[model samples]
Target chain A: MFNAIVSADTLRATLDSVSVLVDECKIHLTDEGIEIRAVDPANVGMVDLRLDATAFESYETDGGIIGVNLSRLEEFAGMADAGQLIQLELDEETRKLHVQIDGLEGTLALIDPDSIRQEPDLPDLDLPARVVLEGKDIDRAVTAADMVSDHIALGVETDEEAFYVDAEGDTDDVHFELGRDDLIDLVAGDAHSLFSLDYLKDMNKAIPKDAEIEMELGEEFPVKMHFDIAEGDGTVTYMLAPRIQSD
Target chain B: MFNAIVSADTLRATLDSVSVLVDECKIHLTDEGIEIRAVDPANVGMVDLRLDATAFESYETDGGIIGVNLSRLEEFAGMADAGQLIQLELDEETRKLHVQIDGLEGTLALIDPDSIRQEPDLPDLDLPARVVLEGKDIDRAVTAADMVSDHIALGVETDEEAFYVDAEGDTDDVHFELGRDDLIDLVAGDAHSLFSLDYLKDMNKAIPKDAEIEMELGEEFPVKMHFDIAEGDGTVTYMLAPRIQSD
Candidate 1:
C-alpha cells in the first residue's frame, strides 16, 4: 500500500527514535507522510514521530497502517552506508516489506497490526521551562552522569539563568551547566525533575550529535524532548516519566 | 630508576602486542631500549617486542628488569588521546609506576619480577616462503574467515605465484587470494599451514592496518608475523602454533 525511498541516515534515525521505547510499532502511512507512536511496556516513556513525504526522495501511498519489528528494520537499514538510498515497498499480498539498498535486496515479514499494543494518546502538560541546545551537549552530560549515579536531576536555575544536569554517586558527583550564552535558546521558568538514566541513555544513543534538541520541563513532571531530522522535514518527540525524589 | 615518555599510540601498540599472549610480563629496560618476550599460558603462542630509545619523546634508564600487569598499564595509557605524550616513571622504593597523561595522573603498583613467568627463547625456524603485504589486507582476510570457521589455512602456491587464506565452515567457505602483483613482495615456494583463528584474530588486532607485515610460512609449522611500530623505531613479532588437520 506504500512505497518510499529514503537515505540510510534518515531511515536509521527514524527507526532508532522509536526502537528505544518499544520493539514493535505501528506505522501509519498517509498521503502526506508516515506517523508512528509507541509507549514502553512499563509505560515509563513514549515516542511520537512524523516523517513527511518531503523527507523521502519518492513517496506514494494508499494510506494503511502496518506493524513492524523496529530492531529487524534497524539491522537492515544499518547495512546501507551514509547517503545511500534505501527503497522500501510494501508487499501487501505476502504481508512483507521488500527492501533494496545498493545491491542487497531482502523481504522482511511484517507483524499483524492487531497483535501490537494500541498507540497511547499524548498527554498534555504545562511544562514551563524550555531549553534548546546541541544534542552532543546533552549526550555528553548524560554520559558523565551515568558514570556516577543511576538517576539524574535536570533543572533550570532561574536566578542564574542557566540549565544544569546533575548526578550524585556514593562518593562522587558530576555536574554540567550551560548558560544563556552557551545554549541555542532558552525560556526560563521554575522547572526541575529527576529521571532514571537507564531510559535516557538508550534514548540519547538515537539522537544525532549535532542536531539541536528542544527540551520542556516542569516541577517533578515528565520531560519532553524534541528534535528535527530529514533536514527538518521530520520531527521526533520523546516523553519520559520522572522518578520522584524520595527524600 | 627508569623514566620514559612515549605517545599514547606507541604505548598502546607495545602493550597490546604482548598482552594478547600473557597478562603479566617482565620488561627489560636497557640503556638502548625496552624488550619484552612472553608466551601464552597455554604455550600455543608467543610475542617478541623491541622498542628503541628513539621511539620515545624522552628516555632514561638504570638498566633493570621490572614486571608489570599489561592490562593495568593499558588502562592508564588509554586515558591519553592519539599522539598525546604519556610520561612513565618508576618508583624503585615503592615498586610502582607513576603515569601521567594530560591532566590525569595515577600510580600503578608493579608485580614482583620473580612472580612472573620467565621469557621464552625465540625458536629458530627455516621457512621456505616469505611474503610482505599490508597488515590491512591480511586482517581483512582473517576477519572474513573468522565469520565462517574457527580455523584457517594459509599457504603460498608456487605455480600460481600467489598467497591465499582459506577457511571452511559447516556450510560456508571464504577464500582470499593475493597474487604477486597485489602484494608488496612474494617469494614463491612450497609452504602451507593450518592455524587456529582464535589466536590469529587477537594478534591481528595489535597490528596497525597500514603497516607492512612480513610473514614467513612453512608446511605444518608456526607463522612469524613481523611489523614495525613507532615509525620503524619498534618491532613486534607474533608466533602462533599450527593446528593439525586430521583430514
Candidate 2:
C-alpha cells in the first residue's frame, strides 16, 4: 500500500509555471531531499524546487524511481476535477504513471529521469530577517511590478514596521507597501534583499490564496519562501539568488 | 465624455479569447451600418461583430467615429484594475484612445480605421426548431466533446424529448444528454445539425454560467446561438455554419 498526498491544483500550477522556465525536469526523491530542477533552454534561467517530506502523509519506497516529461503529467493533472482524488500508479517497465481520477484516465509517458540537470549548489544562506505575510499581498505587489519593471527590490525592516517592493526602470518606478499590521509577524535585524521580478512571479503562481508564506531575506543573499499548501498535506519551498543592482 | 458599460471579467475574458483568432480589428460607426470586423492574418477566420444603436445605454455622436487595432484596446482593458471604470478619450490626429480608469492612465494606439474589412453577407434562414438551455450545461457538453473529437453533432427533436451532443473518433465516442427538465424550454418538430467543435468551443467561452442560451437548429441551416452577456450590459450573438459530416 502506497499513500502520498498533495493538492492537485498546487502541483499542476507549479509544474505549469516551472515548465515555462526549463525543458527537462530532474526531481530527487530523498525523504529530506524532495527537490526538482531544470535548466532553461536559453540557459539563462534555472529552477530550484524544494519541498519538505514531512508534508506528505505517507512516503514508503523500497527502491528509488525516476521519470521524464513532467510537463505531460502537469497537463493531465491540470485537468483534474477540483477536489477529486488524484491516484498515481507507476508501471515499472514502461516507466509511465497511470493517473486516474474518479471519472478521468490518463497515462503520462515518462522521460529519462536521469537526464534532468543537477540542482545548483547553493550555500546555506543565513537570512537574518524573516516575515510572514499574506499571499494575496505579495501577488498584488508582483502584479504591480509586472506593469512597469523587470526587476524588483524587496525590503522589510522590523524596526520600521514596513514591507516595501520597489521596481524601477528607465521610465518609471512602481512600489507597493504593507505596514506593521499587514505583517502577520516579523522577526527583523537580519534579512533584506533584491531579486529578479521574473523569478518571483513564476514562484508566486503556485501559492494559493490564504496560504501564509514565510520569507527569509538577507542583504545580497538568496531569498527563500516557504509555502504551507495545507496542513499535513505538503510544504513547498523556493530559493532564488538575488540579482545584483548596478547603480 | 463617452461612456460604455460592459461586464468587467466577461468583456476581458471574451476579448482575450477572440483575440486568439484574429489580428487587426476595425470598427465602423454609421447610422445604418454599425459593425466591427476582425480578420485573421490568413483571411480564413473572421468575426463579424454587429450591434444596433438601440443596444447602447446612451448614444451621442455628431459624426460617426471609427477605430482600429482593437487588440491594443483589449490589452489596456485587461490591465485595468478589475471592476474599475474604463474611460476612453479619442485623440483624432494620432488616432489613439487615451484610456483612463478612476486613477490610472494609458494610451492604446489605433490602426487605420479606413482599412476595416467588409462584413460577410449571411442570409437569414428559417430555423424551425429552437431550444433554450442553461449555459453551463452546454459548456460542459462542448468540453466533453473537446476531449474525444474535433467536431460535434447536435440533435434536437421535440419527439425525442431530449437534446443530444455526440462526438466520435477512433478511440471513443462521447454523448452528453440534457433532458426536458434540464432545458428552460424547447420548441421543436424536427431539427438536427452539426458544427466544428473548434468554433463551438470558441463560442462557448463567451457564455456565462447562469445565462439562458437559445439555440436554433435545422437540417442544413447554420446553427445560431443567441444570448446576452454582462447581465444584458451588452449583447453577443453568434451564427455558425454547420459542418457536413463525412461518411
Candidate 3:
C-alpha cells in the first residue's frame, strides 16, 4: 500500500517522462522511493525513471509493485494545476489508484501485472563519450532539425570545439552548433551517432526546460540521455537506438 | 492602396473576434478606421468589428473595401509574439495582403468582393435589457453550460439583484448567478432568451479576459454582445439569433 501528497508538477513530470515511451508499466514503491523502467514497443528505446520520497509532500508506503496505465494517469493529471497538492492512494484490494485534486476524487483501474511484459534488466555497459548540457539547448536543436528532416546526426566533430547536430532533408538541411561557451559543460570525445528525430522529438517533449541533460554516446550505437526533474528529486533516462548512418 | 503598422495583438484580436462567425469578410478601411460587418454561414449570427486609428501604431488609408480571409490571417498571426509590430500592406495591383511578422512575409490572396455574399444592414432596433459585466464572467457562464448542454437560457431573476444563466441537460442542470456586486452595471428588464451555447462559447474564446462585455437582450429577439479590445481602441459586437423555447 502507498499514500502520498505530491506537487502536481512533480507527479506530472514523472508520469509524462515515462508515458512518452510506454503506455503502461509496473511502478515499484519501496522505502527508498518509486522506480519505473520500461522499453518502447519496437524495442528501439528504453526509459528508466526514479523518484525519491523527497519529491512528494508526504509519502508512506510498504514496498510493492503497482501496475499503472500512464496515459490514464496523464489524463486525470491534466485536471491539476502546477504546484497544487495532489493526493494519491493505492488500494491493493481493488488494485486501483485514487487520485484527489481540488476536492475532486477520481479512480483509475490498474492493469494486471501478469498481463504486461517483464521489466527489462538494465545492463551495466560502459560508454566512453559523455557530454552534459541543459535540456533546452538540445530541445532547440531537435526543433530546428524538425524543420528540415526526419532524423538528426549528433556527434563530436574531430576539429571542432563544440557538440554538433545536423539534419539533411530532401531539399534543404540544417546544422546547429553549440560551443562550450553556449553549453553548461562540454567534454570533447570521439563519439558519433545518427538517431531518428521521430523518437528524439517525442522524448524531448516531456523534459522540463531547465533540466540538465547528460548524453552518453558511441559511434553508430545507441544514445543514452539522462535528465533530473522534480528539482533534482527524481531522474529520467532515455536510451534510443541509433539509425545506420547514410551518406 | 492601404498600409498600416498595427500591434500583433490588435491584429490578432481583430481577426479572431470576427472569424468566429465568418471565415471571409469585407473590411472597409476608411478615414475613421477599419470596419467589418458580416453574417455567419447559416445566417443565424452576425459580427460587427471596428478598430479606430488609435488601435494602430501608425494609420493611413484611402477609404476602400479589402476582402480578407481571416483564417489565413490567424495562421500568420500565430507566428507573432505579443506586442510585436506587424506590418500590413495591401497590394492593389496584385490583390494581395502582405503581412510581415518577425522578418517573415506571407501574402494572402484577396477574394473578389463581388464573389462573396453581400453585407447585411445592421438593424437599429432598441434592446430593453442591458447587462454590463466583465467578459470573463459571461465567458465562465458559457463554459459551464457547454459541459451540460449546447444551449443556455440567459435572463434576470425577478426578485434577486443578479443576472442568471441557466442550462438544463437530460439528467442535470446548472445555474450561475452573478449579483450586482459582481457585475459592472446591471439594468434588468423583463427579458430572457435561449441561445445556443455553441455560438457563445466559440465567440467568447477570442475575447480578452478583462474586457467589459455588454449584453443587450429583449424578449424573443436576437442578443447583442459588445466588448472593447486593445484598451478600448477597438469595439466588437456579436448578434446571435435566439433559439426558440421548447417545452
Candidate 4:
C-alpha cells in the first residue's frame, strides 16, 4: 500500500519527462522515494527519473511497483493549477489508484507490472566531455537546428573551449556555439556526436528554461543529459543513441 | 504611387478582422482614410472596416484602389514586434507592393482590383434593441454556449432588463445572463434571434477583451456588432444573418 500528497507541478513534471520515452512506466514506491525507469519502444532512447520522499508533503509506502499509463496520469494532473496539492492512494486489493485534486476524484485501473516489457539495464559509458548551461540555450539551439536538418551535431571544441550545435540541410545550414564564459561549467574535452532532433525536441519540452542541465558527450557515441526538478528534490536523466555520420 | 507607415498592431488588427470574412479584399485609399468592405462567399456575413489617416504614422495617396491577399499580409505583419512600424509602398508601374519591417523586406504582387469580387452594399436595418458591453463578456458567453449546442439564442428580456444567451444540447444546456447593471448600456426591447455558433466563434477572434462593443438586435433579424480598433482611429462592423429556430 502507498499514499502520497504532492504538488501538481511536481507530478506534472515527472509525467512529462517519462511520457517522452514511453507511454507506460513502472513506478516503484519505497519508504525513501519514488523511482521510475523506462526506454522507448524503438530502444533508441531511455529516461531515468527519481523523486525523493522529501519532495512530497506526505509520503507513505510499504514497498511496491505499479504500472500506469503516463498519458492518462498527465491529463489528470493538468486539471490542477500550479502549487495545488494532489492526493494519490493506491489500492492493492482492487489494483486501482485513487487520485484526488481539489474536489475532483478519479479511480484509474492499474496495469499489471508483469505485462510490461522488462526494463533494460543502462550501459555505463565513459564519455569524454561534460558541459553545463541553462536549459533555454540548448532549447534555442535545437529549435534553430531543426529548421535546417533532421539531425543535429553536438561537439565540444577543445581548442576554443566551447560547445557547438550544427545542422546542415540541402540548402541551409545552422550553427550555434556557447563558450566557457557563457556556460556554467565545461570540461573542454574532444567529443562530438550526431543525434536525431525529434528525440531531443520531445525531451526538451520537460526541461525548464531556468534550470541548469549537465550533458555528457563522446565521439560517435550516445549523449547523456541530466537536470534537477521538483526544486532539486528530484532528478531526471535522458540518454539517446547517436546516428552514424556519413563521410 | 502611394506610401504609408503604420504600427504593426494596427495593421494586424485590420487584417484579422477583414480576413475573417474574405481571403482577398479591395482596399480603397483616399486623401481622407482607408476603407475595406467584403462579404463571405456564402453571403451570410459581411465585414466593413475603416481606418482614418490619424491611425498611420504617415499617409499619402492620390485616390486609388489595390487588391491584396489578407492572409499573406497578416503573415508578414506577424513577424514584426508589437508597436514596430511597417512601411508599405505601392509601385503602380509594376503593380507590386513593397513591404519593409525592421531589416526584412518583401515584394508582394498585387491582384487586379477589377478581377476581384465587387463589394456589397450593407443593408440598413432598423433594429429595436441595442446593447453595449465588454468584448470579453460576450466572448465568454459564446464559448460556454458552444460547449453544448451548434446554435445559440440571444435575446433581451424587457421585464428583467437583461441580455441572455441560451443553448440546449441533447443532454446538456447552458444559459448566461447579464443584467442592465452589468453592461455598459442596454436598451431593453422586444428582440430575439438564433445564430450559428460557427460564425460567432470566428468573429470573436478579433475582438479585444477591453474594447466596448455595441450590438443591435431585432426579432428574427440579423445582428450587427461594431467596435473600435486602432485606438479609436478605426472601426469594424460585422453583420451575421439569423438562423430560424425550429420550434
Tens-place lDDT per residue, model 1, B93-184, is: 98878777643445677889999997888798989999999999988999999999999999999999999999999999999999999999
Interface RMSD of each: 7.8, 6.0, 8.4, 8.8
Listed per candidate, the RMSD to the true structure in angstroms reads 8.9, 10.5, 9.2, 8.8
| Model 1 chain A worst lDDT run, 10 consecutive residues | A167-176
Give the worst 10-residue stretch by lDDT in candidate 4 chain A. A167-176
What residue pairs are clashing in model 3?
A: none
What order do candidates take by lDDT, descending? Answer: 1, 4, 3, 2
DockQ (C-alpha based) per candidate is: 0.04, 0.04, 0.04, 0.04
CA shift of B160, model 4, Å:
40
Among these predicted structures, which one has the highest lDDT? 1
Q: Model 2: clashing residue pairs?
A: A68-A111, A128-A190, A129-A190, A129-A191, A191-A217
For residues B60-136, could you state the per-residue lDDT of candidate 3 as single tens digits?
89879988878988888888899698989999899999888878998989988877777877677698778888877
Give me the runs in candidate 4 sitting further than 4 Å from their true place: B1-247
- Output the TM-score of candidate 3: 0.55
Q: For candidate 1, what is the recovered fraction of reference interface contacts?
A: 0.00
Taking the tens digit of each residue's C-alpha lDDT, what string does model 2 give over A40-137? Answer: 54344455565555544345443354655766777777777667556666676777767776688787777776666655554576788788898887
User: What TM-score does model 2 score on chain A?
Assistant: 0.82
